[model samples]
Target: MIVAEVVRSGFVESVHHGIVALTVGKSFGDVDSPFFPRSSNKPLQTVGLLNAGLVPREEADLALMSGSHDGEPFHIERVRAMLAAAGLGPEALRCPADLPLGEAARNAWLRGGGEAEPILMNCSGKHAGMLATCVVNGWPLESYLEVGHPLQKALADAVSRLAGEPIAAFGVDGCGAPIFAISPMGLARAFQRLVEAEPGTPERRVADAMRAHPALVAGTGTEDTVLMTAIPGLLVKKGADGVAAAALPGLGAVALKISDGATRARVPVLLEALRRLGAETPEIPEVVLGGGRPVGEVRAVW
Candidate 1:
């Protein structure tokens, strides 16, 4: 699908092609194509942690468990707390060491002469949650990332059950955890289930945590944070490789995958999907800059 076009100074300079699926009684593109949800699957995985007897000391911890945090101070502090509560440490994390994912946070870390570390990885919260779950179940921390491990099996079951579809396949994610491939519509179905599920249910708790702590899900000044903050009762998460999934409590769910994996194209397309679902969102334009000034913008035409 012709999802978005980059217009520079009233001229089309480039375009982004992708698939967008929304449950607003209208559809566009091939919503049935199977793809990895990436970090977008974290919430469902966190639900799996809860089901496996992983009791967090704080409700805010649940937010971190579902987050792809920016490695900001608060984010790192929670991650350490989660691990400490489990008697583990950053050395136990299996995700590759990396700097913060947020622009501002990363800049600050570098300015402080910081180097990449395991706990600083964007996925550390998820990893820490996984480790804590492992401790609760007596599972091996070193093998938690293995697909055959009990933790991974539980996560697979949760993702499948919530998405209402069996996994088409499995692949290693950037964070070293097993990733599931599901249809875009299936992903949308899962997110819808989260928001619409009854209060106190695992799914609803995950949704509530994300909506309540949108900044933890991504970071300050990021699109996911901005969108979730501005749109009431909306839950959104970004996945790597241009994947994103979101649900509005009373509206519907939407999922998309940009064919070229371009980050800039995802939000405009997502905003369009939200608008289709009758969501009132803030004006978030993808300004195209030429010589440090606004030249044009990326517009969604899907």
Candidate 2:
């Protein structure tokens, strides 16, 4: 489906094709087809961690455990804290080292003469949380990222049970953790369940933590953080490869994947989906500039 359009100089120069799943009316594409949800799976995996006996010293730590955090200074501090609390170190992380995920942080890192390190990876928070779970269970921290590991198995079960659908496939994520494939519809269903689950349940704990610490879940000025912060009781998570999922406590839920993997199209389409279910969303700009002036914009075409 052509879900969004890019205009430049008052012309429709391009369009974004994608699949969208909504809890309300008609879906835009093949919602039944399976695809990797990427970091959007973090919250589900966090629930699995809690179920596996992982406990954080502070409830806010759960937000980082389920976050795809920008590699900001605060983010680094928290990841290190999580690891130190588990009697581990940055060496325990298996995710590839990378520059900070946000442009401002990346620039600051370069100015500070910093090199890429595992602790600086955007997913290190999650990897650190995984290590903490292993410590709690005396599981082999070295093999923690293996798909066959007990932790991963429990995560798979959690994802399956929450989605009310069996995992269609399994693969390694960009963060080196096990990623499960499920339908877009299933992803939406899983997010809805998280928001609606009773308080103190593992599911609700994940939702509440993310909602309460939106900045930890992403970073300052990011989409997920902005959405969750601006709209009370809303949950949002974006994944690599153009996948994003969101849910309102009572309104509805949506999941989408842009076929061309364009992140720019995500917010417009997501807002459009939410509007279809009668959500009031902040107006995030998607302007196209030409010769240092605004010329056109990206808008959801549905």
Candidate 3:
């Protein structure tokens, strides 16, 4: 579908195309195409950690474990706490060192003469949870990112079960963890199940924590944070490589992938899908800007 179009001075300059999969009381689109879910798979992976006997003192920690956090001070402190509980440190994290994902935090780090650190990586909380899970299960921590590791096997099982489909393929993600490929339908189904899980269950716990602490899940002004704030009870996650997914309890779920890997295109498609599902959404500007001014709009024309 031509999901969005770019115009410059009354001239159509570009178009963004993508596929959207939505499930309310019914399913829509070519949702069975296999694609990598990336960090969208974190919530399910945290379920695996919970199933493997990981129990953090603070429930909010569970949300962080499932987050692609912005690496703000709050996020960093929580990750440090998780590592401390496991008697581990930043050195144990498998994700590569990087500055905070939030611009403000990154600037502050630079201003303070900081260097990239593994704990500051967006996926650090996830790795910390993995290490804690290993500690709880008496498993090896050094090679936890390996596909054949018991931790990975457990996460795969959780993902497959929640997705209601077996993984079609696997690849190494940017953070050095195994990424599973599943259909968009499978991704939506997983998120749907996540929000609908029984109260106090691991799935619901993760969802509740995320919904309650949306900032920890992403950061200020981020898509996930903004969307969650605007729509109550809405669960949203954005993954790398132009992937995004959302689920609202009792309403529906939506998942999309921009074939050309344009991150900006994902939101319009998602909002369109939500509108189709009869859910209320705030107005989202579709205009594209140039030279600090509106040059054109990105409109959905499926």
Candidate 4:
């Protein structure tokens, strides 16, 4: 379906085609197409870590472990603490070094003459959690990201179980960790399991921690943070290449992907899907900008 239209000078210039998957009722577009969920699968990976005996000191810590943090000061401090708890440091992380994802933090880092550091990477917390799991299980830390590694295999199993589907393919993520491909329906199923998991279970624990510390899941203006804040008990996560998923416990779940990989098209389609599911969502602008001025708005066509 043409979920979003881009206009310029009162004329439609482009359209975005996408799919929306739901846990119940009818779905739109190609929900069965296999695609990489990217970082959106972090929660399931954290579940694997938990199953491997990784015990974080706080629920917020678990949230951070499942987060693609913005590399703010608080986020960095938490990652450092996680590493410290496992008797490791930034040097132990396998993810490549990168600048902060938050605009303000990036500007500050540049102003202070900061350079790329593994701790500043968005996936640092996940890496820290993986290291902690390795420490707890006495597994080899150096090859933790390798596909044949015990940790990666465990993660694969957890993802398959939660998604209710076997991985169709695997690839390396931007952070060097393994990524798995599943249908949009499978992705929605995983999130449904996450939000609807019984209380006191590891799945529910991760969801609760994320809902409790939404800021840790993403940055201030990020979609996940904004959506979760606006709708209590809602779980939202976005991945690279225009993929996103959300689940309202005991209500409904949605997963989507834009064909052109435009991140801007993601939220509008998601909001529309949620609305169809009878969810109350905050008003979000779908404006397109030109020269820092609003020139158009994206609207869902179906």
Candidate 5:
């Protein structure tokens, strides 16, 4: 297990546990064990959207579909337009709505006395995409969140194929949507295919969209977007409760799940994973305090 300690106000306040490391053309510990992917399943779900012809073939909104956005006004507006395009409304969204994560955006909304709209929810784009799929495939808008739904079944099959494993479990997401599980290695393999997928394929389209529109993929500033923007050809995705993955085409993939559930350490763990893969970037600076002092370091446990 990997231990990530959090230091605040000059003291250790919390710790997050997880298994994080790089595997080179091979699976790491318990990579075969199935685990629910939560939001990490976004890219796989997009395949259904593509296959059903609900979304444009040349477009890839994979990043937004998988993103936990900051709820910027622009993000909210786009989500709204997406829903409108699908002939749906905010009431149709199963995900909870909230303000953007960015202080500027949140405060601005407050200053304007803007109430939280479903579109402002970070998962709004994902929900909108799902609704669009339902419209395109003539699926019922009601109970679309059900596991047995055709759209969901297709998504599950796509996930299984990408992970090279069968779905092992199911759960409800915070957004009131179905969630599927796969092993750590399975998760890694899914990401591996995402980056290495054949060009023009659904998987590759998602990758390309994410690569092309890093900002729209998340928001003005978010880890997933920042990492992709900072590095070339590095496909990154973040999930709830400290789950994250990074895949480099031909190099391999890395998946992390924090045991203690502290998500604050996600960025550090991801940076460590990148380091293990022998990839370098300037964003991963050592943890430091106000005095320019090294507070605590993020070291790989593998």
Candidate 6:
């Protein structure tokens, strides 16, 4: 199936086109396709921190561990604090630094004459959290992102188990960490286990933390933070390249992949999924391209 449109307004005022594959019922689209889950796997991989005895039973830390923050000052400070607690520093990170998300940080960076600060990098938090895990586990700090590392192996295994499928492919993520691939259904299943893990398990702790501190889970104005906060019992995460997944503790899970790689379609698809499950929101989410430019709208394409 192909999803597309000819936009006549806003940023997409010209001819706007895209494609989305549709698989309903028992059908699975390209079950073994090599597609990257990107940051969507953070919550599942966070189990490594718990399993390796790095986490000290702090919900906020767990949430931060699974987060892809917006690089706000508070977010940067918390990441630094995590590293400090673990006796590590910014020099320990393997992820490359870049400007933060949103206009505030961008404007700040511009004001600083287009200089890149490690704290302004969005993945700094994830990298810092990984470094802390290494500190607590006594693993070598060098090449922590390597697949050969014990921590990486443990994380891969956890992903395999939770996904209930062997990883079909692998690649490096933007943050210099290994990325795993699984079908959309497999991704959904992984999230299901993460949210429904037995009490006292690392997965459960991760889910609980994310649910409790939704704000900390992402940042001030992120989709994961907003959706999870607005909808109780739901844990949502948005990954790179228009991938997103959400799970309800006892209910089912939903995973979406935008074929054209438009991130704007993600939240709207999530809202549709939620509404279909008998959940309602005060306002329908609007899909905007180029930030506030209405390229297309997300309606029931089914």
lDDT of 6 by residue, 1-302 (tens): 32223343433332212222222233224443547788888888888667766765356877877888777777777878888888878778778767777577677768878766665676676677677778777888997899888888878888888888898887899878888887777887788788788987888988998899887777786788888877888888888877888887655676777666767666666666655545665465555454656655554342
Residue pairs clashing in model 4 are: none
Best by lDDT: 2
Q: Give the lDDT of residue 233 in candidate 5.
A: 90
Model 4: per-residue lDDT, tens digit, 1-302? 68888777699999999888988877889899789988889998898888888899788998888888998999999999999989998899999989999899999999999999999999999999999999999999999999999999989999999999899999999999999889999999999999899888889999999999999999888778888999978898888888899999768899988888989888888888888777988889778889999988887777
For every model shown, what is its TM-score relative to the native structure?
0.98, 0.98, 0.96, 0.97, 0.89, 0.87
Candidate number with the higher TM-score (2 or 6)? 2
User: Pairs clashing in candidate 2?
Assistant: none
Better of 5 and 6 by lDDT: 5
Off by over 4 Å in 4: none
lDDT of 2: 0.90
Which tens-of-lDDT digit does each residue in 1-302 have in candidate 5? 54566665557655666766355754334556667767777877776667667674236455677576777766777777777777877888877767766677889988998877767777777788888888888999887889999878887888888888888988888778888888777787788888898898888888788788777666675778888999889888888877888888867888877765666677887777776777876566436465786666544343
Candidate 1: give its CA RMSD in angstroms. Answer: 1.0
What are the per-residue Cα lDDT tens digits for candidate 1 across 1-302?
Answer: 69999998889888999988787766677888789989888898989998888888877788888878888998998899889999987899999989998888899999999999999999999999999989988988888999999999999999999988899999999988999999888889999999999999888888998898888888888778888889899899889889999999889999999999999999999998998899888889999888999989999987
lDDT tens per residue, model 2, 1-302? 79999999778999999999998766988999899999989998899889999988788888988888888999999999989998888999999989999899999999999999988888898898889999999899889889999989988999999888999999999878889999999999999999999999999999999999999999989889998988888888999989999998788789999999999999899988888867888888788888999999999997
Clashes of each: 0, 0, 0, 0, 10, 0
As a TM-score, model 4 comes out at 0.97
**Model 3: CA > 4 A from native:** 25-29
Please write out the lDDT profile of model 3 over residues 112-187, one tens digit for every residue. 9999999999999999999999999999999999999999999999999989999999899989999999999889
Better of 1 and 5 by lDDT: 1
